[model samples]
Target: MAPVISSLNPNHGPPTGGTAVTINGSGFTGVTSVKFGIVAVASFTLVSDSQITTTAPAGTGSVALTVTSPLGTSNGVTYTYSVGPVITGLSPASGSTSGGNTVTISGSGFTGASSVHFGTASASFTVVSDTQITATAPGGTGSVPVTVTTSVATSSNVTYTYVNSTAPVITGLNPNQGPTSGGNTVTISGTGLSGTSSVLFGSHSATITAITSTQITVTAPGGAAQPVSVTVTTSAGTSNALPYFYITAPTIAGLIPTTGPGGGGNAVTIFGSSLALTSAVHFGSAAATNITVNSDSQITATAPPNVGTVLVTATTPGGTSTVGLGDAYYIYVAAPVINSLIPATGSVSGGDDVLISGSNFTYIDAVFFGTAPASFAAVSDTQVVATSPAGAVGPVIVTVHSSGGTSNGATFQYQL
Candidate 1:
């Protein structure tokens, strides 16, 4: 048996077996059989005494190709099956709280893929071509090996990890002030949040509905609550703590009326919580001489003096609550009303003494030209002598604050 062997022109192909390989050498004419390793060839054509074209077989890795003829057995020619399709890289390793991501796998030898796996779970894959594959990822935890299988063999490990990325945190909440039987929806914020399992206000579990990567809207749970820490949990882990407070709506615990002066200079105290930052005290239609927030539960205000019934209102962040009718005070002084003033025009540069005549002047405390203070002396129950303060020469409001409620501003003038 005399024969000569050359080589396989093109030796590698898909595992599905569709590639033209040319074996070139002498004694190929009377060839009886052509073998791709142990696998038999599908078909072949002897182009010449030195050329024979055949299809490559299905397998993984390399194999030798040979042809047997009546003349002799041809020499073995190298034919590599090629390392089957591999998973080179995966895009987004993590998905959403909803979970359903179509990912791409890039690598070589993907010509005849049969199946794709995300961890042990099988994923639907589409062979887009030779080097690209699109597959829907299955529900999995942590990182798992991604593999691709062909008619020949399965490729090894590729990393694809699932993660819960949500940042749900509580910033500030109301009633600072809710009942201990918690049922308040508190707004929470942060980032990277999803698939939340639970929300905790201290040890109490808050019911949560809307959970996102940025925020979690939750209803507070009941407790011996004042202000407590809030936490959220996911499959990955629990979140950091935040503070929430529960407070009682402010109440007008009491008012100091009997102790307050009949002339209205006396400071009246109020007790309450959840008080608005700027709570005003009013006596009848007239506001107090001075109002001050002592704390969440207390306010000290000067009663506006006038003999009549008055109501005290305690306002808070939640809403407003009134304690008593005439609870603030029923004083015995006449409210000063600006009737008229003589010599109303004066120079702001001092040296101007003007007569301010109005009813109930005995309770007059001080007069102001706009915001500028002026010195005045009580001339009688209806007269006041005041020197205008040095200030910007403009139309001024001469107010007469007194033991009674402040008078309506009397218009005056300041000459340059």
Candidate 2:
């Protein structure tokens, strides 16, 4: 029986060929040859008794695709070879010199696009439809012609322009001064900052938190106590430099009534230089409240709750004071308690050496015998020695006083 030709899958392809054509027909078994017009296909596979897959050889225009076997020659099926891709337009005609923009090229005959180019530079591309292709523009400068190439030919009706970018400009910085230790957020306002790649303070790079066309927020990096140049960089160029200052940390020379109750809440007068802008006062890791800046050299703050001795520090825009820098010590002590006294009886004439034993005896300021003040020496955290003062011949209440507070009284007898 003679082979009966039915149809060809993908009846049209580029003129350069290499298109895979599937011939569907009857009597295709033992197929000896397949041809496009009078040209023989070099590669083919007999998929089944009714099917033959073959590569279309290089050709032009429409041609008769046919199959031959021992039974007979099959009737011809029509297949047309197409011209190269045509470029009608580009979605974005201009982009940055650094490139990386996706441009849509629209036209016809794009079925087998081999490459897309911007001038001499080849771009990565994807064929979206028969008339449209998306290509990523490669890095380039100035105006460049865009073209699409198929296996058969190349089209060059569109142009792509590379625009040179403008450098970012820094106009001002909010809260421009900060501690040498850094970690403060600063807002930078400027122009042409849309695509900022980097922000530098002096030679240190700052961490950008937020960015916009005209402003950027960044966390300042640590730097020396001096003025440094701040600049922004983008694909275009580096911006002009602006001044940013790093101030020295405040020093705490002293604190009035440097000792306080363990439960805190005592008012402390802090003396130091660069204290005008004090933002915080810390007892150890706890922050003080109700802070009042009296002058450039003084601040009064209420101590936060704490225990034991802690280094007091004042924080300003300049920075935080370090421990051991000056007289910045604060001792949190529990009130002294007098449990007993060694000599319970003393003469009214005065001068009696008495040993007072109790808890929290360190930093004892004074000892009281009735209404008279007695001299005392802090022997340890739990003991004190005192010389009793003269008092009326009667039972006298003896008490110890410290920065923590006065202790409960113990009765002592004074004899005439």
Candidate 3:
């Protein structure tokens, strides 16, 4: 029985074709060969008694495709060999999500383009020549395939991406606050920061140091000691505003009871302007403890262990206080020591004149004999004379007290 020709799945392919073609008909079993025009297909396979599949041999234009069996040859079926349109590139390959932009398509084999398409949406286009077609982009989003179709075949696709034109969004700022002297670099983190045109800190324009799609760094502009808004502008639009605070330098006026013990730990009240926001207090380089901000003009702190005189300073959100400002001086004095008593023995009747000898006798305020108070007179920086008050007829310790602190006691025997 002779093979009978039915149909081809794809009627056409490139002239250099390796197109897989299927022929359908009864009596296709034991097909001796398959041929396109005079050129024979390299190979053929019979799937069943009714169908044979083969690769279309390389040829040009329309050709007669046929199958032959052991019984005879089948009738000819028409198969076309063709080269379809190709798009190598497109001008302005990207456009806004809302399309309607003119795009110049460049390539070859477009003499009779049946239609142009962005993805599945057909678009109106003019076949400029056999190599070019000027088309208007249709509305779309993200990336889509663009292709040209002819009566013979649809061309392989090139991609055209649609850009989202949303304004930039700010997520955070590094070093969002700084001193009023604006020269610090501020880094802004966000999305869609590309193509930034301007950066602003309040009404002042900032110098852009670097920029990218996700981040931008700019030199902040100087402004008043207050809060300001920061923003960035791009081609799409302006970003949302963020806050930046400009702080002033702190100051110190004076300190109450500027004199304390060298061993420290005395409660000292600090008086100054702009003290409400104080975060830390320092005496020279030593840090203070138990800081309390009573008002914008008063602060109390425990003086740290130190000696000699040094300036007291406060640190706030603004800045650390500078030296030579206000009366911030503090004096550190050592406690009075009673190393010996010139007359160790005193009458228990209580009027015993004793000469106290030790270091740090200056600023001595009180003298004590055992548990009783004594009248004292400072004679020198290392000496004090005291008249002992009535005390128990036994051993009584003698000591001296100064603004700096209390001193170690020296034992004195009182005889009856």
Candidate 4:
């Protein structure tokens, strides 16, 4: 009961043989041969004992077939000879699905390979000889057809093609602005910005490392106070916000006088432009006897007394500039103490006619003996009528001209 071959006639032939096959079965007795693999079929004829009559030889496709019995052997079925699998080549037709692709498939029968498909994906093959086969491509979408499935009995339509590779695209982000405590180092152009997975300034996700394709280096995420929009993410999607901006540092706009004269020298002229960084120009709270930061919008302070209107500020690093225009400047009367003046002497070449009395010559505007040019004729605002044009006389200083001021010196005499 070891004989089974229910039909086989010209099923397919060609490997070097004419054709004339006929073999139906059911316990063929003592027939000792009929094999289409290992090639051998030169006109067989048993005719009964179940039946056997063949004529086909020459090999390439369709095999794993057998029939040789004395009472044993006849279980491998399939015999279609005429060669069919022939694909030519395929080594890296494109890949990405996280599939770790490593393809290499040449053509012709690929010996003993039972499966290797890339279209519906079921790959993991290896048959490196007889025409190469080293596959690992399973996660397809665009192009597919690199197949090789064999169980022997030959069957081939021959095919190999699979491609799907796309990863890159992002666009815009230059100064987008930021400041909520965020550091700010943003530059993200676009178009597949090289492997950048994240960089957002609006939703708050920054700290992206440097990457390129158009450039992407990010560090901005504190909470966003003003400027927004800036996004970039890759794997293939997300990029189109681009706008960053944030500014809040430079303020102090009103303080012209606010208060002056307390022993705090008093020359106060802080107009405000960050006041050029005036550290202490306080007058109502005390501490501004002398502070001079002349530019950035002027500051010449000298006033500290605990006054009635206090508030004139200027601080930098981008943070304080207050000048609310309160106004204060007045503490006069201490102008008239020309202590002593007797006879000192004067004479350089011009006749010395001198007599200067001192006390507090008010508002005087003309008198000089050392720099020569004194021809005063006032005498009654503390006295004056000085005529000493070319002077070099030792201790000489007599200046007095009135209107309620000018005369902190007097002592003259020159006769040569």
Question: Which pairs clash in model 2?
Answer: none
Better-scoring candidate (lDDT), 2 or 3: 2
lDDT of 2 by residue, 1-416 (tens): 87778998878777778888888888888888888999999979988888888888999889998888887788888999887778889877777798876788989988788888899999999999999999988999888899888755688568788888766788999888998989999999999887676899999999999999999999999999899999997655688998999988889989998898887888999988888889999999999999999999999999988898899998888978876556898999899898999899998888889999999887788889876898878889888888988888889899988888889999999998
How do all models score by TM-score? 0.34, 0.55, 0.55, 0.23
Question: Quick one: best lDDT, which candidate?
Answer: 2
lDDT of 1 by residue, 290-378 (tens): 77776766778777655645556654433455553334334445667777768878776865887887787775677877887888888
Q: Candidate 1: misplaced stretches above 4 Å?
A: 1-161, 164-185, 195-197, 205-212, 218-225, 258-268, 272-291, 295-297, 302-311, 316-416
Instruction: Arrange candidates by lDDT, descending.
Output: 2, 3, 1, 4
Model 3, 1-416: lDDT tens digits are 79888888777777878888888888887788888999887788889988888888788989988888789988998999989899999876876676766778999989778899999877779998999999988888889999998855688999998887877898888888776878888999999898777899999999998999999999888899999999987645689999998878677888878888997898999887777788999999999999999998899999998989898999875668886557899999898877889899988888878999999988888999987899978999898999988877789888888869999999989888
Q: Which regions of candidate 4 fall more than 4 Å away from where they truly are?
A: 1-4, 7-24, 35-78, 82-84, 89-92, 100-114, 117-136, 139-147, 152-166, 172-416
Cα lDDT, all candidates: 0.70, 0.87, 0.86, 0.60
lDDT comparing candidate 3 with the true structure: 0.86
On the 0 to 100 scale, the lDDT of residue 330 in model 2 is 92
Clashes of each: 15, 0, 0, 28
- The order by descending TM-score is 2, 3, 1, 4
